[model samples]
Target: MDTGMIIQHRRSSNIHSLISYHAHVGAVTSIAWNLFYPRVFGSSSADWTVKIWLLDCFTPIQVLDLSSPVGGLAWASSSSTVFVAVTDDGRAHVFDIRLCKTRSLCTQQIRQAHWPALSCVVFSPFEPVILVAGERGFILSLKLSPNLRKLHKEARGADEEKLKELERQKMERIISTSAIS
Candidate 1:
């Protein structure tokens, strides 16, 4: 089955080339583009793979294999530094585009953090981080490096404590009001 299609009209041929691409051995169901590069990317459910292609080229430039069907794909435009792909098994594969012409360096792989499937992945515009949304209403933000993760954890603890203190004050206010009445 044709997963995704793009059509181009040629004046000389008086016809259009209907190009249909399959992401994997299975059907290519969805396609995404890199905002900062002239590249196109697509994913398929049948074979659970993500393929990257140069614009106007039918052949894929790179193929990323996944253990489970792919649910989402994303590319960073800030420097064309990274490409991220998420799968049904809650695994995210991070690749470095700079090394694509030489060695295939998978910068990072996150596993078992998401349940069901990750439906979408996006990068933060203000920071070097990624946000993933998964099935069962699961939302998570993954930082590129360990330093960010540690800072995030510390910030979360502080926020939780602040919330708890606010709750305690709210309860005290209600008790005093009721006692006076």
Candidate 2:
């Protein structure tokens, strides 16, 4: 078992790296397996690229290269085709992975999202909201416009009421840990 690669455990207390997907040239910065779509996952690397792959296969479905290294990636918890990737140059990109016609380009991109460097990008489980964190402890919250139609509106404050509701929902979860951490 290669310790540096991602492994998944399904339906049991067993862990395994299903395939040998050496998807990056340099250090892999982040990996995100879609919580809802079991077959899909995303990875970012210091090699200046973001790669998306499917389970049971070794090669990435698509790769997006940038001028700077990518340090963070996350799949949208609510959508089947949406994901976010952050670069070391302080930019966060929103991509519709299903857009195979142009996998090298992003559907929407947010630049200068964080000073120094952008570190992470995460999507809300319930709403079209994104949270970003980076250098100097700078944190930002942006709500995707209707249906993720707009990524340029504004990086406003979070909605306290909705966030509280989501927290309440999580408090009700009752399950076992059966997957990769």
Candidate 3:
């Protein structure tokens, strides 16, 4: 299977099967997993829609209406709490994936994040932080709240250990020069 494709391998027979998930009329561009439910999320290139599928039933759980072709997708770990998607038109859409039917009740949108098409979007390893990458090597860091933003800024700018290491190296260089002289 490809990087985005999910596959199941049979141990005994060494046979692999592609997990039958969604029925998309267009090419499936990206897929993400729902943290709360046994489901997978996917986006289509031609249809410009996001689809959620139940794992066991292999059926589409929901479809999100979008205007541009989807380029990337990600989900929050808090179970139907937040889902993120980027489009070729440089728009980022965040939505609630809590619904069971093929429709979402509420939606939130972020637009024009990149000048060109966006390539990928993912949640930070630290949680509540979203990382987006796009064409021209564009990258964006987004925080869910002001508190999260403060924490992220601190983490990104923290340099205590590096400073200490630099000091140690300078001292060692000085000592070596003195001994040589």
Evaluate all candidate structures by whole-model CA lDDT and list the values in order: 0.57, 0.64, 0.57
Candidate 2 — worst ten consecutive residues by lDDT sum? 171-180
TM-score of 3: 0.60
Write candidate 2's Cα lDDT for 95-133 as tens digits.
764444245334345555435677888898777788987
**Model 1 deviation from the true structure expressed as Cα RMSD, one decimal place:** 19.2
**All models, RMSD in angstroms:** 19.2, 9.9, 17.6
Clashing residue pairs in candidate 3 are none
TM-scores of all candidate predictions against the true structure: 0.62, 0.66, 0.60
Sort the candidates on TM-score, descending order: 2, 1, 3
The best candidate by lDDT is 2
lDDT string for model 3 (62-172, tens) is 567677778788876432435677778766776643222333333335446537677789887566778888767879887666422232222355485653344344334
For candidate 2, the lDDT comes to 0.64
Pairs clashing within candidate 1: 3-28
Top model number, TM-score: 2
Question: What number of backbone clashes does candidate 1 have, counting pairs of residues 3 or more apart or in separate chains?
Answer: 1
